[model samples]
Target: MNILGILRDGTGKMAVGASVAAFVAATCLAALPARADDVTWTMATHAGGHWLEHGAQGFADKVALYTEGRVKINVAQPGALGSPLTTTQTVKDGIAEAATTWGGHVQGIDKTGAIVGGWPGGLRPEEWFFWVYEDGGLDLIKQWRMEKFGVVSIPCDTGETEIFLHSHKPVRTIEDFKGLRVRTSGAWAEIAAKLGASTVVIPGDEAFSALERGVVDALEWAGPGQNFKSAFHTIAKYIITPGVHYASGLTECIINKDAWDKLSEHDKVMVEVAGRLNLYESYARYGELDIAGWAKLKEAAASGNNEFIKLDDSFIAAAQKASNDWADEQAGNNEWFKKVLESQRATLDKLETWDEFRLPIGGVRE
Candidate 1:
């Protein structure tokens, strides 16, 4: 005992013993075998050559990186495996291991899907994120997917504000919407129908031909960049601003339940992280691309071939009123819809107070 005390106090033998123990533990850990199996998944998307598709590709790449190439994903362009409208079922039935789809497309399957996807006079992309991530929205989404579609859902991408109405005729007032044939979907379509406009549901790829053939007098399809990419300006001269109908659209990565369950815990987390990263990357990229698109539109406007019109405040107010009324009716009809809609509305009310007091960042242009 006297010799032990002397070594601890003067010889530093205790520190040497601790170091040796740490080395032994490290060596034992290093001797364990690593996970050796590699997994590759196939994912189908609802859109081809759009920013969302680009984001899907990014997710695949990032998943591989995060999983150290142990997990890989191959993304199929829109309609590759099945129609966009049927993608939810396709993923659920294991026709594809995964799918990237807008929530509205599956509303017919479950009304709750449209509310999560988007709603008229809805929260913007940033606000939607807070509701989904910070609030209990994500859990509700997962629950809904599991019960309704037998899949795991992750919000993977978000679109910017949609162009309210690309019209062949100028719509300057709420009254102007009467009898206006519009191509739209989800709640907006229902709201427009309530406001006396005839609404049609068509695939985005068919929008151009529909407009050209006079199948619809007006249509909404994404923001400036995507609208430009679709050459909407060439067909519809009046490009409406401030897309109130759909302020933002949320897209999701839907994975087959069995496939997702088969993934290791680490690989599952990597997939989730990749989805969130894609949301931010896609939003930022769309912002940059839209700026370039607006410049081109301005040039076209200078030649008197196109015009950007701001929807009248009164018209927007009326639309909001109709939207709220329709939402209430839907909530009345469906319990699950009511749960999600009320949650979102409550979140919006809480955010509105803070949003109103924030100072405007940039000056109004003359």
Candidate 2:
């Protein structure tokens, strides 16, 4: 009683009570588990050996690392969960919590997907990376996916300049592309068709077999980094340079809305962070690999039957016009596509500021 009385002047008593309350709260917090959410979400990807699959595991690992075991990403076996073209559908269907897939593959569902996949005459890897994080590009992608697909979209993997075509014939003119049985996807397919080329939308995994079986005369897959070993060098007579179909490559992670909604804010952030980091890493890793891959292809060409066909500047100019025209047509058909394309173009336009400050005129032309 005396000890209580000693500390119990009304204000002192109030302070003592507050301290007791804080102690109880601290004890309750300490008793709780460390992870607010112990969620392990499954992510679908292309088959095992594919770059998308490689990046899927990398992103998953990064999420686990950032979340400190609170969140785990369960990456599925190659083609076991979804195909390159169907992974987004798998996520939308709730078969997988998320998928790492090219947005262009889903262009059949919505024309805008092609723009998100980094369309022809669009951003390069570095510019795309900058726009995604700094500008409102990421937010726009998230918005579009949620609004249209009922899923969450994260830009997980971004890299590669892309090989123009692994072809059995040389292509240096619009006439060269015309009537050519080529395998490609997304907006490029549409543009190629308009250019009079017969374009088949085959998944990358099947591209090699199709080329071998004469199902398609040529294919445009990743840059030399992956193309060198994709067996294209062995089968194709021509390795076209400066991917005019699409300058940069971008792949998205489509998350099931339910799964994403369940994650704690902290977990959500870690997931986004992991995807963002994966983009930068892929860009750097592939940049280096593509350089070496180019050398490898050249060396292989010296002995093997491969030939590097740099698309004529005039033809590239034609492709650019066609790409811009395709974008305009698609934009007219779909408002979402129009909006996003405008935003992207605006970003590219802003980069024109570099022109004013250029000490030398030696960089990317388009």
Candidate 3:
């Protein structure tokens, strides 16, 4: 009879009882007129910054506006609920109703997380969005979430290409990476390890202090704008260009499946529209901010305090090879990962010919 107690019980012995209780609760809630008028959800996020917070808050605002205040989402960032790595599970466990998170943080739970979140040598943001919107990627993501985490997820935001690394020493070549201590996560960490670097998986919040204290010799964060906001330039003199590890970032808005299913069809559609709007606005904002951040970095470089170095082509080629090998090994072990990778590669292959000619027309040259 006690709904919360049954839902919170850890033992599987109460599974049937809990299900019955949940169904009853849902039925009761649906009958209450006030329930429809006062729906609200809380979303947990990893860090607080323009790159993430703006989009998250924007989504919340749009959802509220679209639903005419019928539904509200409270955004909590800087790991208020838990670290980024744990937020997905928090949503899945019903401790939180929703989360705005990087998919890679949940890679341990589902390999598809890494692929959707942003894989090493992965598609660019536009290509990723194309795959998700037009090439069945969204359906695959939904299936993966339902099967792996008991959640529903949608792509809510896309981030620009990230800076490769912020380091105390220049990492110009593959050999230069040997013996370096780097802070990264998911497949990129695996690739870094293959390059003979010691890789540590630490929360983004801890990266600044870790690099400043010499705990990590190098680290990669979101991108130029975010790094500038975090004052990474002050801590590391070398700013590496072209984030080969993760070409573009994808942030997902995840909701517990039960919670999602409880929503009215109209409300559900509103949430989806809000997510799409957030995706567009977030990427555009990042572009504007990144340009401003780059100007500051250029100024610092001119002052001889900071230097931006492009990683050698040979090093990129080698890292790409390593990334491919890792992906192939993962595909051999996980069917879902294999499926997602195959889908992504197919999408990329189809785009390659178009890109070869399209990219050269008005592409910026150094």
TM-score of each: 0.87, 0.86, 0.87
Full-model lDDT for every candidate: 0.78, 0.78, 0.80
Tell me the deviation in Å of residue 360 in model 2.
8.7
Model 1 pairs in collision: none
For residues 102-136, write the lDDT of model 3, one tens digit per residue: 87888876666787889776888778766876688
Give the number of the best model, judged by lDDT: 3
Clashing pairs in 2: none
- Cα error, residue 88 of model 3, in Å, equals 0.8
Tens digits of lDDT, candidate 1, 1-366: 121221132355332233432432343224433355797888888876564456678778767865668878898877788887778888988998888878788788677777888877677877777787667787888888888888999887878888888899998787888999999987787788888899999888788999999999999988888888888899889988778899887888899999888877656765776676677667778887778888888888889999889989998899889988888887898888899998898888888777579865458867
